[model samples]
Target: MDNLALIESFGDFKDEKGISKIDLMAIIEDSLKTLLRKRYDSDDHFDVIVNPDKGDFQIFLNKMIVEDEMSEDDDLEIELSEAKKIDESFEVGEEYTQEILVSQLGRRSVLTLKQILSTKLQEYNNAALYDEFHDKIGEIVVGEVHHIRNKHVILLDDEGNEFILPKENQIPSDYFKKGESIRSIVESVDFHGSKPQIILSRTSPVFLEKLLELEIPEIQDGTIILKKVVRIPGEKAKIAVDAYDDRIDPVGACVGVKGSRIHGVVRELKNENIDVIQWSKNPEIMVKRALGNVTVNKIEINEETKYALVYTPVEEISRVIGKQGQNIRLATWLSGYEIDVYREKREDDDVNIDEFRDEIEDWVIDEFKKVGLLTARSIVDKDTDVLAKLVDLEDETIDDVKQILKAELDI
Candidate 1:
């Protein structure tokens, strides 16, 4: 075999596969040692060198220069006369080396070298992929869709690496179209089989957070900070935000002047309902805002258990519960609390219900008219539990409302 052509081919392979030249050299040296041991049957120590500037490949065996003409161990020593015959620079008791050309390693080694190179290349490729994506977990990636089959998509990123988007990781409102652009977050990177696999997801909460950062400049610049985010796939999502600069209204800025900013993120999410609420240190106040489309009259919390009792009006119960509890579920997830919702009932007071207009949830007053219930004074004397069913609330809420009315009527 022509050693020059082999070396040139390996150089080109190293460049194309992103394999380090030094690593290839190590593999070559290892392969040469194995070949020499198998073919020459000598356990003598030697060093392999691939100095392309000097020669394609060479193997040098170190030997001690002895004054005697013959040595007891022929492989480990060379007589001074014999060493001088190979290289004029030879001295007794000095080290001498004999070089063997790579071509001389011979035709029998060709198959083994090929197998070894193939295995080494695969190992290097896996290493390169792992290094490329280990820190990219949870990062947003933009790629072009290359192929789609059985609801799974193949995408090629800017680096020319292909990524698979499985059906389960995709949002229900989204579909992969060939040759279209898609954006997703890196869910995980794994080495399962022969190669490293990068798993991508469109339904992940990080994807939504990234989309917000992309669309809203304020969020990206830290003017509006995203505190927490939760998603129910294509159905609903809620994100809590805080204002680093008090001048910025976190929710209003995210929502834009006329819902323009949030609209961009909503479009990208395929119109998934997004509720950008303000984050509060008080879990009770935060849970109240997390109810999305529903308004909570009051929130009571059990901090140790991370549980909350949220009271909304009976008229808004359907909105609070949402479609199959999705609204409340996302609210609970965003607030970091397990919330139990209760309908709020107002206690009858000597003063008219209209007197505390700003203090009560609007839905409660609407329900009063719907049920033909009269003034607050009428239900004041009624039993708390029975009045709860009449007003669609819990007894605890009714008692709390009575206390509130008494306080207000203290005049």
Candidate 2:
């Protein structure tokens, strides 16, 4: 261990930046300290020292000096004549350095050192990434759209790390232009591959909640609480809000004076529809409200099953069900119940057996054309009650079949 050889073993620490010898000494000392701790189980015996000028590191195993004839375990005995050769005052209890060879370490020990250095470097990188994004959670960050696959939008964040915005987590109608910058809140950070993975999202309910918190001071101040939110991304969202403080109106605060506050959140969601509703402790009231403006005649709930059967006017059925069942689906999700919608039957529109039979019979006869039974008149004229006898149908079934045939034949 000459100084020059030890320094060269560290590769080049100086290039354009030109690191000083002291820096190399510190690095080597720290490296050796970690290596000794990992390699040896002893507590207070081993010590490491680095000399900048010599570019070398030294390891010392502390031992007490003793007389050559002493039988004490605490001392490494040397004759008095031999001790005076090194120094005149070299006492019997003094400690001495014993040079260690790096080559004396086994292959595993070298591997352990390499692993320690790699792990430390990775940890340093991870720490740097954490420092960069720790303060950015819940805040919007812009990322470039790299590619879209399996409904997941792959985005490159500001740090050049790829983040995934799962398709189900993205607003359906929100299209990302290739290479275009998309803005979304940093939903979460996960450490992966020596760096913090930044997860971004636009369709998360938290995004709306955060947007409200930003726009409405009442929410941020803790007066207003978001009770529940149901969203059909890029289509519509229903938010139920309540105020802990009586002085604050949660819905009104979120809606602004004339829809200003909520409109801001909607705009940020790419102009998605937002309905701000006052939260209610009553399940019926909350469910009715969750169904939006659709009028419910009555709500019958099976508590055990958590199912709600809502009766509404026939015209309002479509309203409650929404387009393609979005309304009912959102209502169910928000209300945490299975919902079955029922519409009241009009008085004049009561089902008549003859009319029903006629309608069905007409369909059957029309269908029978493909099977060569084209006319209800021909079927009804049969003597053995052809439908009941031939098809072995019950009386009611035969009668229904006759009516369907007649209706189908327009007879």
The sequence of per-residue lDDT tens digits that candidate 1 reaches over residues 81-111 is: 8888988888888888777665655665776
TM-scores of the candidates in the order shown: 0.73, 0.61
Task: TM-score for candidate 1, please give it.
Answer: 0.73
Using TM-score, give the best candidate's number: 1
lDDT per residue as tens, model 2, 196-286: 7777788877787777888988888888888888787788888888988777778888888789877777877888888788888777887
Clashing pairs in 1: 348-376, 349-376
Clashing pairs in 2: 3-54, 65-92, 360-404, 361-403, 361-404, 361-405, 362-404, 362-407, 362-408
Give the distance in Å from residue 314's predicted Cα in candidate 2 to where it truly belongs: 1.5
How well does candidate 2 score on lDDT at residue 8? 72
In model 2, which regions exceed 4 Å deviation? Answer: 1-30, 34-45, 48-95, 98-119, 127-140, 144-162, 178-180, 191-194, 245-248, 302-305, 350-411
